[model samples]
Target: MSDKDVAEDRAANADMRSAFDTSAAGPRPPSEITGHYSSDNPDMVQFVDADGNRLETTEANAPYAQIVEDMTSQDAREIYRDLVLVRRIDAEGHALQRQGELGLWPSLLGQEAAQVGAGRALKPQDYAFPGYREHGVAWCKGVPPENLLGMYRGVNHGGWNSNENNFHLYTIVIGNQMLHATGYAMGVQTDGDVATGDPERDTAVMAFTGDGGTAQGDYNEALVFASVAAAPVVFFVQNNQWAISEPNEKQFTIPPYQRSRGFGIPGVLVDGNDPLATYAVSVAALDRARSGQGPTLIEAYTYRMGAHTTSDDPTKYRSDAEVEIWREKDPIKRMRGFMEERGHAEPDFFDEIDAEADEIAARIRHACQTMPDPPQEAMFDHIYAEPHPVTERERAEFVEYQESFVQEGAH
Candidate 1:
């Protein structure tokens, strides 16, 4: 054959081999593929609609449905309480910021269900690493509400002791908590605190972050470490649509949950607004971790109904229609509907909750106004576990400097 004829033959052979390659063969049977790409897939798992309607699903939605069905009457009530109380506190914090009582405040208005459900599912021994906005989780973990506010108010570096609350300080740098949480889980393993079939002694770590956090190097590294070490941790990503005006689509072509597959970990996507769904998935993941299973990634499909923080004005980049779409799926409202349907609570119960909410709002206002500013010396006191001569000398110098500046109207 001529040189050109030989090259053509080789190319033809390569094409033939590619067409009949059997290396990709599996046990699964092949079916006629029907391809359609539309956003209107009804098979998506949703236990509760935006209108507070209960939904049904088949085996396809079984995993998500499990989360929904796990919601009990008491769970519904408690979740509602958490949502209301946290929002009241959030509003007060925002007002305080406006009034110059606080340096900043990150509202948890739209994320109550995600925080409450996941927080409530944790065992007392399970440690939690939170991002800055997790006031709701802090509350559920029994950290005083003031403790969270104090940090934002610039009165303290971090208000509560992590050891006392089993809640770590709110990590401001995105995705840093993932490494910390993984390390803690590794410690749990080193101590052999994992369940050897003993439920009570088993422990896990839950780490929180946002959709934007998923793009960070630390976040990906944490997942790699957790998977390789089989660390008992759950990476809870609350994909509330917007990470400071950037939508989820801008960050990912596929959902965040799919990212877990690359790390050899199971990934789950739940309707984050559904308290029951959030609770169910979180509890199960924790249980699995306790049982020596590796880390799981949960992408809570929710929306950020409020600004990223008090400093952000989301209206500059997002539309009112977008916000309204999420408002319809409000987690608290869905739980209320479930509670009323089951007769777990009555209208009077809701009234009582409202009254309590008002009382909480009032208390927060009082606390914000009355919480004394920390003395300058207090900053030096907590810098180290033990005294340092250099710090002491600096503190004395600071005090002397202040005294020297005293107003001089002849005393």
Candidate 2:
């Protein structure tokens, strides 16, 4: 209990702190390089490698390969078109945000194939519960690209009715859509719309979430419900390797897809950057769901090539070398390479696609500029399905306040 005893105790604590310091531990190996369990696992389904070469369909991919084999040259070209067009739309959105046209924008720059492939795999009867960055999926659901800009442009909360388009409004809360999708799938099963043996009559649901969302309590809870109910839903995790600034390694030790099996649902991992692989895997998963085989989890291994959102700065956390590595494995470029190699696409086809993308970008830019701003009173709209006195009162006050501004000759 003296100064000498205190000095010894302080010295011991300093040693313990130094032992736990990660900075003093020196640089740990990159997760992409050291922690890639997929590369070593032969069961991982991968149809194409980084350089765009087609790999043989192995046992790992056998279940999903049939759909890809049935795909025609025209189908391949169409996939490529969708991929390029979506990238253009995403790029344009990012530009709009930079130009101060939008409050914020989430770029799906590198994950286009993951969205497009899964989106194209759905039937008209199926429903999708999407996370906010699902612009590519929205494109496939027949939602106009401009519809997505409404929330960002401060026009509306969501621009479309989910029931009308079979795509739910984007859920900003991470992992919340997983629950919505599960509940919707349970409803579909209760309605007897599943396993009808008639493709047109059967229905399935897709729940889209990012790697980060997988860590949320809602995601796990949804999995429990879906497993017990045998719900016709697919939990699609786009493991873009980062949940904003937190890397996948920081989120969990096990791969996201692998975690699905613990919930009694089958899990499949695929190359998210490969459109063919993603499409094939999604088709198999969707088919299983429609057949009442219960839910499946698919983790699309991709990289977020841009900042998580306009408000983010990726350069602060990640190295440029890492980004450059992913750039070589660009999904759109890989698909284009595969198409050209198989003689399914020509130089002219790519040139035409470029022209189309350019036109689409121009249209989006014009539409964003022309979008009408919602009146301040409209902020209270859609807060409740039915009229509420509080919201009505707020709207009235907001309108009166605006009138007072005009009366005072305020700009």
Candidate 3:
């Protein structure tokens, strides 16, 4: 055939197929049928709406719906309790920061549902690696609210034991936990703890980050590693619509959930403000991981209802009108409204919860004020599991420096 004829034929065909392609250009997987984000064709998996109404399930959410249906009234009431308690803890943390108790606080004011939902779905044996703002998850993982504050309070490196709750120390560097979680998940597979067919024996790992973390190189690298290893982990990205001051538009054109498919992982987006939706979806994803299905990425579509940290003034970048709009969709409010509407909880039950929250807040305030400052020598205490010459020298120097101060006073 003539070169010109061959070129013309290729141009006429216009269909380019990569030799590496295994998935034919036909029907997409059920996990991928939900397209990119759009209000008109919204595919966000949600069981409840902002108005406290239980939504009708669609094909995308039917599996998750069964998970939610399996939840009892008592189960819901416990979740509601968790939501209230965590919100209170978050409030106390913020208030303490403002009052000069904590060095800084990352307020999780609007994300109780997202954190609590994912937290509650975890099995005790499942390991989780969290970013700095996952206070709600910490609470769900049985980390004392005060324990979380110790790190942010500048009192300790991290107070809780990872082995105790299978929850790692908070990673302050954005998106770094993804790698750690992926590695641990790979270890779980090596240990033969995954896909054992025994529900209790099989374990999974979870890594949490915000919408902004998805933009980080580490996050992408972890996904590549997890995909190749078929790691039993879930990348829970809380898309609170903003990554610090940057909105979704500034972050990326494609949302995190939509992008997971690029890495050969299943992805789903859920109403982050709805705990029921978040919990249902989380359960499904965790089940998939335990069943040897590998990693799944879930984007919890929520919002940042407060400042990024004690140091940030969100008012500079976002409008009060927008904040107010999200305030109406508050997770606690909606969950409470839903309970009341269904008569799942009585008025006195809510009243008791509020009263208990007040007491907890007071106790937290007391704890903050009374928290002892660690001795200056403690900075050198835990640097190494075994004795190290460098750390010992540093400790000695610090002690000498402190003794010199005392000598000066005596003189």
Candidate 1, residues 33-55, lDDT tens digits: the string is 00011112332335666656666
Query: Taking the tens digit of each residue's C-alpha lDDT, what string does model 3 give over 1-411?
Result: 799987964653342222212266753332232223332235688777787788787876787888888888888888999999999999999988998889999999999999999999999999989999999999899998888778888888687888999999999999999999999999999999999999899999999999899999999999999999999999999988778987665566566786798899998988899999999999989989988999999999788888999999998887777777778889988898888888788888888888889998998788878889999899888789999999999899989999999999999
Stretch of 10 with least lDDT, candidate 3: 13-22
What tens digits encode model 2's per-residue C-alpha lDDT throughout 1-411? 799987975774464344333554444445433345445457578887766678886888888777888999999999999999999999999999999999999999999999999999999999999999999999999999898887788787688888888999999999999999999999999999998899898999999999999999999999999999999999999999889998765677567776787799999988898899899999999999999999999999888999999999999888888888789889988998788778897799999999999999999899989988877777797789999999899898889988997889965
Off by over 4 Å in 3: 1-40
* Top model number, lDDT: 2
Clash pairs, candidate 2, are none
Best by TM-score: 2
Residue pairs with clashing backbones, model 1:
none
Model 3, residue 164: displacement in angstroms?
Answer: 1.1
Residue 328 of model 2 has an lDDT of 88
Candidate that beats the other on TM-score, 1 or 3, i.e. the better one: 3
Report lDDT (Cα) of residue 78, candidate 3.
Answer: 89
- Which residue pairs does candidate 3 place in steric collision? none
Candidate order by decreasing TM-score? 2, 3, 1
